[model samples]
Target: MKRLLAAFLAVTLAVSAPIAAMAGSASLILDARTGKVLASENGDVLNHPASLTKMMTLYLTFEALNRGKITWDTPIVMSKYAASRPPTKLGVKAGGTITVREAVYGMIVKSANDAAAAVGETLAGSESNFARVMTQKARQLGMNRTAFYNASGLPDERQVTTARDMSTLGVALLKHYPREYRLFSMTAFTFRGKTIRGHNNLMVRYQGMDGIKTGYTNASGFNLVSAVRDGNRRVVGVVLGGRTARSRDAQMAALLDKYLGRASSGGRLLASVGAKQPVEVASAAADTDAPLAAAAPRSEGEAGNAPFALGYSDTATVPLERPAALEEMANAGKPQPSIRGWQIQISAAPSADAARALLAQAKSEGGTALKSATPYTEAFGTGANAIYRARFVGFDSEQAATAACEALKKRSYDCVLLANQG
Candidate 1:
């Protein structure tokens, strides 16, 4: 963490003490408990996000764990792709599996690129798919100024966000996933008997500091997402594009101190308490805004509505056909023989209760495949995550399914052929 404070400013014409100096850089420090902005510097200007991408990665993961889509104990299978991430990573080799509990640790403390990919793959079957899901969910969270191209915040011209948008994410993370959010406070994470200390200076040197994240790159400079709790009051701060590690941290400390005094000045920061009203969340219109696809109809007359996070501007309903459904496949006479090219071996939930979720895709597609869990949409505290499977069971030929899987993999799906005889 200290490294960033110095290295960041080496190239830039230095700014004086008592004030952070850097142009094209933006920052925000706010009251985490009260949601008040303390200091600001072009907080809304679009800039590269760097490793800050992982915060959302952790955010969506917490949601998955809470909803039972995954558990902390669940093992995350490392993939060749995940192992390919750049350094500042754990370097967990492909085919080695780590429990979700450990992956979070590796991500938080080590900032392991491998762990980020593992989490992305585990949730969406590929990082690309997960990135798609991330952007969709971000929009739903009212992150109008942001888009994510990957789980790791490597620079992408199109994958950009502003300080303001990140503040929304930072606060939402604390508000929505308190239990999981605390994991960010881990000053150090030990894995395989080795300790990887966190880079956030606040966790170690500052008072009331908790978990969040830090990001850096040639393009992004030094970025930190931080939260502090002083007594019953807590605040979140985002400092981006610092020229030096000390500058950023000191800047953060100074910013937080500045705001807290204002928040307590007259309790004016919380003055809007009575103005609060239920705000139905809506997504910033995509280039082409579209509405949620129609819910799938089951043979038993059940309506399976997948949670779609996209709130497009062009609301055009396809009135299209739901894809093949599992119930329909079972209802229709003889079970089709095993699909040759692509298939997913679905483990039925215990007591067969989880079958509907597993079969959600089949239900939505109008019974083309079998699902084991009830097909339901996953809603995090602040966003909706729809379950989407590009490859399901029962392809008639491996040649075609393999072709599709290959294509989907390029788009970030680690699709494998699942042979099901049952």
Candidate 2:
């Protein structure tokens, strides 16, 4: 069984001992550049995100990087509260201070609880405060159903997020901070001058796996939030609350190939993981509820780009003209009416401040940039997920997002466009 370390726990070091939960159901998703959902099953049921919450933590940290609040060389002190946290930690002493870069590695590659706690302490004076910040940012991202009780995503029933929500977070993180997102690709991290390999076996074994994170906790089950890139194509995905680490990793590997294609032939790869279980990570979702049950047959339409976001809780936003690709559901309910017209996201920054600052810079350079928040922020939080989107909405076709993205890239902002299903 390959290590399917939860991305949230990857930051926390998965330090806290998990109570252990039952095997989770399985689901899958594929996407296009337009922020669409291609496939999913049982995606929405508010399952545990486990350590995946740390992904938000990393996102926040990346934002700080943009504002120059802390540099890679900045040392993060290990507080007493941080030291007191559970296992899967870096075990930093009270007086011990690790560089921001080291702390990031410990969180992503090692999933050090101590590292995540340090970030919480360094960012907001305490984990509780940082969690508040996280929740606030989550609201900004339109993650209406999410609540962060802890930074480490230890099994608090309240620390719930859906797969759809997680996907939203993943997309935001990738698009919001392309430069910083590379940190997720680190195959191994060096801490205390000792190198530890990341638990994300896919990065080591698979291709185009830049990253995201993996997580687990007793209540959250084995979970994985991962992504893959193929030339001009890129996609972000998540699998939460599985029976075991092996099952989660296997399922994700299979899913990645299904969407991104096999390297040899550029076609979908064979399913390496045998029978998949149901997915339990609601937080894995970014926006709306999961699709029908995994047992429900996948619609031929679900495999195509349909502008939509998944959520750990639930909400649906689609343009009536172009429906979103089918994804698993986070909960049971009628799909909301699609919002008409195009939804455009022109720019993404490591943080809202940085994004705004960049927009200011753009305006000075004779360009138009607008900053707005989305429901996605409520679920994921500002930690780069609640990106400052600069766009021109109300276009006849949804291509405005793409047009804006192309225009922004000319000025050197790596951009992607997102739209709604009509």
Candidate 3:
């Protein structure tokens, strides 16, 4: 009888080992340009997605914004159900309101479950209904093996996705919403007087990694979907069911190291994917949120002379449209003469003086490249929340602006080229 019991126990252990392994292991890497699978292991195995579900929620939000169903200033009121979601949240109370911009930052930077729920409720009127919409959208996007039961990736046996499906979603985000996709690279954003931070630490250490999502739960272990762009190469990598976040990130970094080099350096992948060309949408002036900041430390090979100051962040700008009256005020005391064509922005600063100082420093360091350019400061927002953009205008063409920007970059200045509508 003892021998029989031991044999039964041995059989049970053997049977459960593979099941456990399958439950907690899956990974895939793909070239975003060619859609070629670089490497995969159990990529089709279903697993919980955890907070990674917020990516889809944000995707739909971006779609809605593009469709004009909502704007950045649109308010998303939190229902009691949404506000009551578990921690890693913005903690907006029931009946409290946050703008669409804040909600997007909350979800992306903090992985706030409450923000996700509020966004879903605002979009679909109910969480269950939103789940259905999410599932339907997943199907539309060819995420065949994926399903979502909630806006937050809270535990639900029904909420499952495969690594391959996640890679598809990552690529879809980059292809379909190239402009909005930049939000994912943000590591922190100020919301409602509080600074909410993100947990995607790997992005800081790994060169070229930008916006993506990370997830974890007891059932899902640690999951991460990462997108990396080095020069002309781009790759999306997904790892699910890691034993810990560190291990998951390590694995992802290793995969990117091995596969990113092999990625093809074709032209814009968006063109090949048949993505709609991004159009310049009219910017709204009322949104008062601070610009999201990518706090990632500069990695080796990055061109930066000095570390960013305490309040200085990434050069990415929030939409800076000004109301007619405010626009007049911002341009006040400046000559409205002959600078036109294109512009290059160097930085956004907390105060107008700081912005001017940045422009002055850039002019001094920029050498002959910026000697003929006109320095301008554009102010946005109101009172304490206001930020100023330091810019150089008067480039004759896009190529001229691009050339100047390239020269500034080599000298370790962050630059963004823009068409001068004025």
Top lDDT prediction, candidate number: 3
TM-score of each: 0.61, 0.57, 0.60
> Candidate 2 lDDT, tens digit per residue, 1-422?
00000011111001112233233564656463554566676666577777889988888888667755557886666666677678888887776778888888888888888788777656543465357557545554555555676778776766777777777777667766778888888878666688788788867787877887888887778888887887866777789877888988888888877766522324333221121222111111234221211111112111111112111111123322221332232333533323244544333223333333333333333233323212111012233223222323334454444554445445433333345434
Q: Ten consecutive residues with minimal summed lDDT in candidate 3? A: 7-16
Estimate, for each residue in 276-375, the C-alpha lDDT of model 3 and write its tens digit.
Answer: 2211111111212223232232321111111121112233323433332232244355454243467776655544544554565566667778777877
Give RMSD (Å) of candidate 1 vs. truth.
15.2
State the C-alpha lDDT per candidate. 0.55, 0.55, 0.68
Error of 1 at 33 (Å): 3.9
Q: Give candidate 2's whole-model lDDT.
A: 0.55
Among the numbered candidates, top TM-score falls to 1
Ranking of all candidate structures by their TM-score, best first: 1, 3, 2
Instruction: Please identify which of the two predictions, 1 or 3, would achieve the higher lDDT against the true structure.
Output: 3
- Order the candidates by lDDT, highest first: 3, 1, 2
What clash count does candidate 1 reach? 49
Specify the poorest-scoring 10-residue window by lDDT in model 1.
6-15
RMSD of 3: 22.2
Model 1 residue 170 CA deviation in Å: 1.2
Residues 1-422, model 1: lDDT tens digits:
11111111000001112222232578887665465667778877877778888988888888776765666887777777777778878877877878888988887887788888777766644465467657655655667667776788865666777787787788778777878887888888678898788788766888878868888888778888887777666667888887877887888888887775564322322322112221211111001111222222222111111112221222122222233222212123433332222343221211111223323322333322222212221111121222222224445554544544444333322333433222
Better of 2 and 3 by lDDT: 3
